[model samples]
Target chain A: MIKISDLRKGIPISNDPYGDLAKIFSMRKDELIKILNDMVNKGQIIKFRALLDHEKLGYRVSALIAMNMDDENIEKVINLAHITHFYVREKNEKFPYSYFAMAHFFNEDELKSFSKKLDEMHINYEILRTVKNLKNDVK
Target chain B: MDEVDRKILIYIQNEFPIDDRPYLKIAKDLGLDEFEVMNRIINLYNLGYIKKIIPKLSKSYIEKYERALVAIKANEKDIVKVSEFINSFENITHNYLRDHHYNIWFTISGKNFEEILKQIKIITEKLEIDDYIILRSVKSLKLDTEFEVKK
Candidate 1:
């Protein structure tokens, strides 16, 4: 089994994976490449990508929208550029929403416009605006 | 952030090279100096535009772990204490304070549902928060967080 902590420490998000990881893990460059290739082939590591800060990218507003809607209607919301995550969640008395979506907007006006669209579509939903992100460990 | 920076961000966010000299490859493709490209990336990080450039784990790999989106209803007074308490757990990947009745929302993952439940129990008892809901993700419709940066 691979030690995730060690691997994470070796290959940070901002550093050069090949050179930095090899140096940090005390492995040869070729060996590190082979290991990374193996991991990719095994479907462990999908692809390397950059995680952008949406707030700095002009997305000032982020909210979690919960709704009890049909799957067909999801297409409408999915087309929106603001939507980041859309998932079908388990429903209960405490949280009666079945469909959940995470959206980010450039400003409140954009959010209002999106909300207006939802209102026009007659989709009953509850908006849970994220006040603060206490912890977000994308490991 | 300018046109070149936007282009670089879009490319890196979508398809980051896996080669040894990845930044050099990016420089070649963009017709810029390797050091310039690297410096721009560093600048982006310093400006807080880019968080990290890491490998995205496959869905199958992630499916090995049990995960759930937990919503906790903590009083406004104890929000900070409760947030700090929940954030202390390594299993908790995401912890956020939302504007709702069930304010504190977080995603927790473990080896199994039992382990996740155990963690929840510990948190509830310790924080004195009995009002909470664990909303397990039934289906992931869209998980992409890539944003198209415009001029």
Candidate 2:
């Protein structure tokens, strides 16, 4: 049986320069398109994304920022630039912060200004800079 | 990575056309010829500006998998080995060497805790380091990484 996992086992897309999905999978183009169309319509495939590398795009100063703020402004917070992942931490007394977000900026000044803006808005937060990315594969 | 390219990136990142010629629709929407958009996407893919265009399954839809973040400690030299070992696991999605005592960080997903545990054991035992934290996500307020082209 052709399972969904089989679709993922093809050439690691990042490593492969040429996308020969039909040739690699040993399937005809029409059949592959049908499967893809069905997947998209069913919401199994969210979208065909072009995930830009923020660092490669000349943006620097990335951080894992933890913020403690009231619940009402959560909608306002997530719409900012370079914020890739935003989540509310599992309720734990020792966790220190309730919300976690990942942000990237062109420089330290920009990063600090964003943080300062959050602070001025009465949002208390802390951050940890990213030293290196080992693996950033989208799953 | 100019204006047209960024527009293409931003447009395609959120939604993909699922027709016989998907690029044709994108061209129509972006006010460009079909061939131009296709060529530009091919170029972007060739350049490492754009990663794979894959199926992004929803959490509720792909409920078989569960995810968590972990932090590990390592000195300068052994960090390479640590990252290699952690990323070797198919389920380990995002791994980073961060600026902290628990410097090495990564996210992993699996069918369940049992599957994740088997991979974790390899790291804990092989590295001979036990300082780590498993932070499970309670709720994802926002789970997108869209770039700004229009801005």
Candidate 3:
């Protein structure tokens, strides 16, 4: 059993209580950790991170960049993503069909310039500018 | 069970209250005496549920940007120094070290993006650490206040 202090000290895999509807219930401590650990071992929870309000902090520029890569060379793209200071990897849910990536810049011109770099590589991609944020993907 | 008590917690989470009779208005809405309402909140706070009672500010009030999640492989020896240094930033609103590669996660709200970037650059240079990651949130869902009690 973890004390209230322990629970508060270490991060709970998630702050969203029902974020994973199937896994989280009214469990606590060992029971909850046991379930989370089991899921982790099974590769259910691949990554976890905190989500914060950047715009509230005055970050007005953000975009979702979709890049089409040769399926054979996807690993190269993923490696590049890890090193890029601003790019994050995600699955493309919509068109113009390709692997999805997202990043934020200081302004529209910066975003465009960044996209231009990908264009130079001849990577097929689409840039989706974020106008408003409504829901956070809490993981 | 009254609406006033429920709303008060919501208000507390979103922002601190800033009025002489913050409870008075709540009391009027609930059709209860002002002192009684105030006493009830005081009791709840004493029970260790809330950290404090303060005023809430609008989003526009915050003005800084750049943020990053830095994980360090330090032992108990340097944890205090690391936390103190990060917490010293006046702009840092939320700081927590979660269990991950980038264990140290902080939310910084400054007057502008440059101010936020300035803070991050200073930390990176001082710490001489480079395995940090910045997971900027793309969206923010309105947080709910429901607490889950374990049986």
Candidate 4:
């Protein structure tokens, strides 16, 4: 069972102190390190990442762009290591959408410049934006 | 680390007492001394379990806007350049290279459709990304579960 102690330890220590389990449990520094390492090895801890408010940072525009892989086999396409955290979904050319994807930018000109590159590469894509955010992790 | 602390977090997650002596009310609910409850809260913060104790702002109550999650397929040879290009924009919030084919993922918020399209154009050009995908969130669900695994 996932214990409250686990919750205490799962508090990501990267940013918030209150999220640190060692401090909450008063564990020794070494013990804290061991616990974190063990959790990571067990796949209970996936990643330590930061979530920022881009709109607050001046990113006024953003969109989702789905693409269709021209190649039948995704070997060469998959080999393109630049793409990260992408998944394969059912392909749909008629819908003008493929697997899910995302992008963010500061201005229209900046976004347009990127589109030109897509055209040159012959990559098909579309853009979607949130009409409203029902819930987001504020803390 | 104990049940009391767990209760404190659960309570705070749902609602934080708005009274002058919020800690006292919290203590009453947990059957603990006011000072002890305050100490536990402080310790939780120090330990890194509780990121923040802030007001829950209802997104619906605020000015409504659209959001999108963009994924990019950049050549690994140009990953750094692509990341730099994406990060250069202040509007591109929460960009990361996760382990996948579409490695570069980011969340973007815009005022309107035009603004969203504009960004898409700029990022693809700047990064020289050949292929990409967009996952539009038709329905969103969020769960607040602290992950902890003990043997």
lDDT of 1 by residue, A1-139 (tens): 3445355422454447577767777878778777877888888887677888887788878999988766677888777678888877788778888888899988899999999988887889999998988775443
lDDT score, candidate 3, position B89: 67
**What would the per-residue lDDT of candidate 1 be over residues B10-49, giving only the tens digit for each residue?**
8888867777877888899989887878888878877878
* Best candidate according to DockQ: 1
User: Could you give the DockQ of candidate 3?
Assistant: 0.02
- Extract clashing residue pairs from model 2: none
TM-score winner among the candidates? 1
lDDT, candidate 2, A1-139, per-residue tens? 2356655542233222123565566776577677776776776756555566677666778888878888776877888766878877554444467788888888888887788778777888878899888886543
Could you give candidate 3's per-residue lDDT for residues A93-113 as a string of tens digits?
322243544465545676667
Worst 10 residues of 3 chain B by lDDT: B141-150
Model 3 whole-model lDDT (C-alpha atoms) = 0.44
lDDT of 3 by residue, B58-140 (tens): 22221123333333433445656776787776555555444434445555655455666677779867877665643443322
- Residue A117 lDDT in model 1? 88
Kindly give the stretch of ten consecutive residues in candidate 4 chain A with the minimal lDDT sum.
Answer: A8-17
Residue pairs in clash, model 1: A13-B53
Give the C-alpha miss distance for residue B89 in model 4, angstroms: 5.2
Q: Higher lDDT: candidate 1 or 4?
A: 1
What is the DockQ for all candidates, taken in turn? 0.62, 0.49, 0.02, 0.03
Which stretches of model 4 miss by more than 4 angstroms? Answer: A1-139, B54-63, B75-96, B139-151
How many Å off is the CA of A46 in candidate 4?
Answer: 30
Cα deviation of B116 in candidate 3 (Å)? 2.5
TM (B chain), model 2:
0.89
